[model samples]
Target: MTATKIAIVGVGKIARDQHIPSITRNGAFELSATVSRHSGVDGVENFATIEELLAGRPDVGAVALCMPPQARFDAAWTAIKAGRHVLLEKPPGATVAEVEALIAAARDEGVALFATWHSRYAASVPAAKAWLAKRQVQSARITWKEDVRRWHPGQEWIWQPGGLGVFDPGINALSILTEILPQPVRVTAAELQFPDGRDAPIAAQLQFAGASGETVSADFDWRQTGPQTWNIEIETNDGQLKLSSGGAEMTIDGKVMMQEADSEYDGIYARFAQLVAETSIDVDLAPLVHVADAFMLGRRIVVDAFEM
Candidate 1:
């Protein structure tokens, strides 16, 4: 079988640690070239900008944009306009409004566009979603806390304006929450706590109201110390369901139900190949929309100055 050629943009932290390894393991894709301002992988062709990459590597069938959310839409639109399928990293674009523009462009060009949610492909996520589909939900809670210094060392964009600080990690939980919930949910209340010297919040608390009359509360913080926690608990009529370690494991009332290894980025590549073959698009912006809504409508506060 022939492999679909893909170009990697940004080539930053996530692209190197996750996307590169996943692309190497997936047989359906070929790493054609890269676009990055500072660094590029050895042997592969490189360009300093997305425009240059697309112009130089005309054979690239698709481009996976691993840049920050702020720079997503223009790269996506450029690739899609050039007849190349576009793949977007999570929190797709800066504003929900820009992604809508990309969607319109993708449709008019008759090409594929994928806004990837790597967390949805987490080890136990499908199982949890299926299990919940058969049960009656009561209420849900999500807690994600981690030390920013350890997880994102030396990264500064996360604290800048239009950057997503705590929501950067918290959006993963939202992906899973939106996927497993049987009914649509709307944010009822939200509170964001920003560091004194930062433009983005370092902590957030959110409340959601579901069509099934269930309430979900989410707390995300980047100040955790020991035993960093990323857990989501759902209280249902049947029992309590818990997904911990960022959906790597699931338990029902403390009884282990299912667990598996994660190949989220690999799954993303495989799906991208399928979309390329079908000449279709799969871009789910619900999770991102919620984040934007939180930014636009949620209450905000400034706290102590955050470092690292």
Candidate 2:
């Protein structure tokens, strides 16, 4: 069988670190081309813009957009119009509304569209979800704190409007939360702290209410200093369940449950390959919608200025 012809747009850090490597390692998809203003892969064809790439390379069957959330919609639209299946990196677009538009467009055009949340594919995450599904939930708390200077380095788009500062990482936790919860949860209140010089919030405290009347709290901060932490704890009738190291490991009470090494990006590529073969679309926007709601409805606070 012929491999699925795939091209990548916005060949920046994420595309290089995750998508490109996964695509190259996976057998089902062919890395046909790439579009970037300042970067290109070795030997693969390169174009200055996605429009130029689509116009010049009609054989490209799918396009993976690894751009900042603010610029994702236009690139996705262009690719869809060019009759290429589209795979969007997390937090799909500038707004949940724009993702809705993309869904409509992809359906009308009869091409697959996938909004990938890499974190949801963490090894222990599926086990946690299965465990939760069989038990009764009482309450939950998520504490995700990271050293932004170390993780982001000089990434400037993370601090801009629609860039999703802390929420960029926080959304990963939410994707897992929404997936494991037996019932749906809604944000009841949120407090966002914006850096003095930035348009986006650097940290957020979110309170959520589940359908079973369980209260959940999440604290997301990007200003953590040393010894970063990313943990989610849930109390159920059976016992306490916890996922630490960004869902790489699981535990209960004080006992080690299951330790899983990270391979979320690989899982994303595998899923995308399956979707391409089935000619199916799998785009879920609940996490993005919760983010938009937080942005639209949450109160904002000004915090210390953050550099880089």
Candidate 3:
């Protein structure tokens, strides 16, 4: 099988840390080019903008957008219009509407559009989903707290309006929740805690309701100092299910079920290859929709200023 020649439009931390390595290891893809003003891969061709990349490398059949959410729509739309399959990083776009528009544009151009949720591809996520499918969920709780300085470093875009702040990492848990739950859920209430001068929140508390009267609550904070936490616990009639280490480990009522290394982006690129081959679309907006609802219904609270 001939590998799909692909270009990555952003060369930031995630691009360097996850996307590039995954693409290199995946036989289905070749990292032919990149679009970044400040950086590029060692051997790949680089362009300053998406327009230049799209026009210069017409043979590059696919594009992976690892840019921030605020600037993703235009680049993705440009790639799709240029007849290239597109793979979006999580929280596909700044708003739900723009992602929807990209879906339509990809359909019109007959190209694949994959809005990836990397956490949903974790090693134990499938097991959790399968177990939950057979049980009656009593309630669920998500406690996702991480130090932003450690994960994002000096990336100031996160504190901006479209950057999603705490919800940036929080949405990963939401993605897992949407994937594992037998029933759908919607946000019922939220309290967002914003730093004094920031446009986005540093912490958030959310309440969700399922159709069967099951309640879900989430607590997300970016101010955690040590060890970090990314855990989801669900109470069921049979037993308790818990997923920790961002879904890399699963425990049921105190027994270790599954544990494995993080290989989510690999699965993402693998799925992208399949989508590109079939010329299909696989954009799930359930996670993004829950974030949108959280913002719309959340009450804002001012907190102390944050600095890097």
Candidate 4:
């Protein structure tokens, strides 16, 4: 089978670190080109803008957008209209409305639209989902904290209006939560802590209610300086389920059930390949909706200024 020619827009840290490598390893995809004004992958053609890439490389049938959420809509719209399948990075768009619009456009164009939640592709996520399906959830707690300097480094867009702040990482936990739980959940309340000069919050605490009245709480903070924490503990009628190491490790009743290396991007690319082959849309807005609800219902708290 001829590999699908694909281009990656926004060759930033994520594109370089995860997307590029995943695409290279996947037999179904060919890293045809990239769109980045600053840097490009070795041996691949680079365009300064998405428009140039679209116009120059019509052979590239798919485009994976790794840009910030604020700038994602326009590129996604352009690609969908150009008859190219689109794979969006997490958060999909700056607003839920934009992603909704993209869905319509992709339908009209008959191109696959995949809003990827990489965390949902973690090794043990599927197992956790299966385990939860058989049990009744009593409660869930998400503690996701990491140092901004360590993870994001000098990225300033995260503190901007559309960057999503702590929800950037927090949404990963939410994605797993929404995926594994059998019932739907709604955000009941939230508290947002914005640094003195930043437009987005550095920390957040969110409360959610499951359809069966199960309580879920999430604590997200970017101010953590030491070892980062990304864990989700769920209590069920039978026992407790804990997913640590960003869902790469799973434990039941404090006993290790499953653990694996990080291959989330590989799984994402593999799924994208299937979507592209079938020309299907796999955009799940559940996690994004939860983040939006947190922002809308959260009480604002001004905190100390954060510096890199």
Q: Which 10-residue span in candidate 2 carries the lowest summed lDDT?
A: 288-297
The ten-residue window of minimal lDDT in model 1 covers: 289-298
lDDT of 3 by residue, 1-308 (tens): 99999999999999999999999999999999999999998988999999999888899999999999999999999999999999999889999999999999999999999999999999999999999999999899999999999999999999998999999999999999999999998999999999999999999999999888899999999999989999999999999999999999999998999999999999999999999999999999999999999999999999999996
Tens-digit lDDT string for candidate 1 (71-131): 7878888888888888899888888889889989998999988888998988888889888
Candidate 3 at residue 47, lDDT?
A: 99
| Model 3 bad stretches (over 4 Å) | none
Determine which window of 10 residues in candidate 4 has minimal summed lDDT: 146-155
Alpha-carbon RMSD to native, per candidate = 1.1, 1.1, 0.6, 0.7
Report the C-alpha lDDT of model 4 over 61-142, residue by residue, as the tens digit.
9999999999999999999999999999998999999999999999999999999999999999999999999999999999
Clash count for each candidate, listed in order shown: 0, 0, 0, 0
**Model with the higher lDDT, candidate 2 or 3:** 3
Once fitted onto the true fold, the runs of candidate 2 whose alpha carbons sit more than 4 angstroms away are none
Give the Cα-based TM-score of candidate 2 against the true structure: 0.97
Which runs of model 4 end up more than 4 angstroms from their true locations?
none
Tens-place lDDT digits, model 2, residues 1-308: 88888998988888988888889888889999999888899999999999899889989999999878899999999899878899999988878889999999998988889999888999889989999998989999999999888877788998888899999999999999988999988988899999998998899999889778898899999989999888999999999999999899999886888997889989998998888777788988888877877876789999888787
Cα RMSD of predicted structure 3: 0.6
